[model samples]
Target: MASERAAAAGVLRRPRLVIFDFDGVIADSETIALEELAAEMTARGAETSYEQARALFLGMSTARHMAYISEKSGRPCAPDFPDVWHGRLFSRYSTELVAVTGVHRTLNLLDRLGIDYCIASGGSVERIRFALDCLGLASRFEGRAFSAEMVARGKPAPDLFLHAAAARSTSPHECLVVEDAPSGVMAAVAAEMPCAAFLGGSHLDPIRTRHRETLIQAGATACVGDHAELQVMIEAR
Candidate 1:
């Protein structure tokens, strides 16, 4: 319905800059990452499922994810866990990662409109860059990627989003955040930015309804089912 309205209006409130979350919003890597995490935790004796892993760490940073796993599993994560996990994840990413469907088209729309855009994610900069490279999007986002490691706090806190806006020389209200996780929506809201919750990630296929409701409840101004709808929302004047 909102997509229809945006299409009819021919103009949504265009933002000065668009801030995207890297994993689920730009790259379809969340399912793979979560599946790996689930297996890792299960092997460590946590006995977690992919869904459970998603619910717990979908938008969390590496440190936070490890902490959550340690707490929930009642097992101390080995000091090298992050390194080991990242090694495995990156291996999978190299072979399986791809851009979210329609993302290139959405980016093209933004480029044609003269809108600036950047990425701000809960992932490490190395991982983010690696993913972009795997998806062949590294050049597009070359110097525009921001990671949680760049800020003292990550998602669900305004720090990272605010940092991204500041880095882009855009005011909070002038930025639009595209996110697929509730924590990310909350962070965008906390940063005083308009947020569009993305429901197009493959990881959301089985839990779209609940995820949509959760994102809305967390303060998303809009929920887009795909980058096509997102393009309409961004193109509306």
Candidate 2:
């Protein structure tokens, strides 16, 4: 009985909206992004492996990525670094990227369930659109995408998630965040939103268990392994 009450205290019951993180949650773009980013940094003399890149910059913007590269290389990245990355990444995205394995099907299910969802991502609006369009998800999220570029502070701060929730007319406690980055999970927690730490990606395989535990410790309400597991949690909630 005591244990049951402890579990009950953590339940959200029903949230009015779902906020998805872009790169790793809805789109399988993290691995692709990290690979290309690592190569880009290497060309600038800041060589890094995929694992290192992911560790150093999982939920940062392109500007931040370039800054890190510049810092590491001890030379500033070109003024056109953002444009350069956008062109390169988008070009490859057209032929190489896809949505998270079962996300389209999961979105369809959410549609059927009458649940409202929008994206709140650290990626720029243009980059988010490119990935979603590549995955044929543009129409579903047409006017509903929120970018960290719109806010003064990004992930690990509650600004972006709170902005997203406010734009959707939902309060923080009335939302659930599906996040694949520790910083994002922390943001959700700070916003008072229940977080579902997602471990459903090629990029997350190596540190999946460690990440899951870390997120739970960071105040995630749950840790889900795949879209199917997320769907189950969604339906139950």
Candidate 3:
């Protein structure tokens, strides 16, 4: 680690690994997921908008989503909430999910740079795998994708990101996380990892300015709105 003076004096170490958050960063699925969640919540009498749902659960597990809904609505979510929500989600995903715009190009750039990357998401392993496979990204990640379920805690807590870095043979400080949510960015910060906050998700494009500031305030070292900006940051001197 370099002192602030040295860091400002052109001393720095390039990160050894890139950790990606999947739902919003890679799969182009967060908006759709939030839409479906809002619909489900409305149907179950919770009645929230997509915006509200996204704000409430951007970087949480399905269990947490349900808990939040229950607490907010003053009614218990159904015991089958997880199964039903996931069923609808996977159904829509089968027909609607796509890779985030420019993901392939960014990945190709990383490949050319010989930079190894992996997915570490608050999403469940099953959901992560399903979306990656749907987006034709499974082979690229192979054994490297990790889930919140694999760790003791999820985002805004460092456990999942820390576990991912450890499993991938990178120390926390040696990894750079590209995240779409404030919670994920905070988790990276807590893990002592440098963060490159991403804001290209369809759900976020509408609120880029606000989200960008929030991420920076949460300790992102860089904020990139799309893969092009990401490429620039990754290759910058």
Q: In candidate 3, what are the lDDT values of residues 1-237, reduced to their tens digit?
A: 124223322322466888999988888999888988888888877888998988878878777877877987899988887678878899989999998899998889888888889998888788888888888888999999999999888899999889988998888878889998889989998999888878888888778888878877888777777887777667654
Q: What is the lDDT of residue 237 in candidate 2?
A: 64
Residues 1-237 of candidate 1 have per-residue lDDT tens digits of: 565434433523689999999889899999989888788877766788887889988888988877866887788877777677788899999889988899999999999999999999999988898899899899999889999999998999999999988988999999989999989999998998888888989989999889888988998887789899888778765
Residue 134, candidate 2: how far off, in angstroms? 0.9
lDDT of each: 0.87, 0.83, 0.83
C-alpha RMSD between model 1 and the true structure: 2.2
Superposed model 3: Cα runs more than 4 Å off: 1-13
**What tens-digit string does per-residue lDDT give for candidate 2 at 1-237?**
224323533475556799999988898999888888888788787888988889877777666787887888999888777777778888899998987888987788788888889999989888998888888889999889999899998888999999998898898888989998888888998898888888888798888878777777778777778888777777776
**Whole-model alpha-carbon lDDT for candidate 3:** 0.83
Where's the lowest-lDDT run of ten residues in candidate 1? 3-12
Which regions in candidate 2 have their CA more than 4 angstroms from the true location?
1-10
User: TM-score for every candidate vs. truth?
Assistant: 0.93, 0.91, 0.91
Give me the displacement of residue 134 in model 1, in angstroms: 0.5
lDDT of 1 at 158: 95
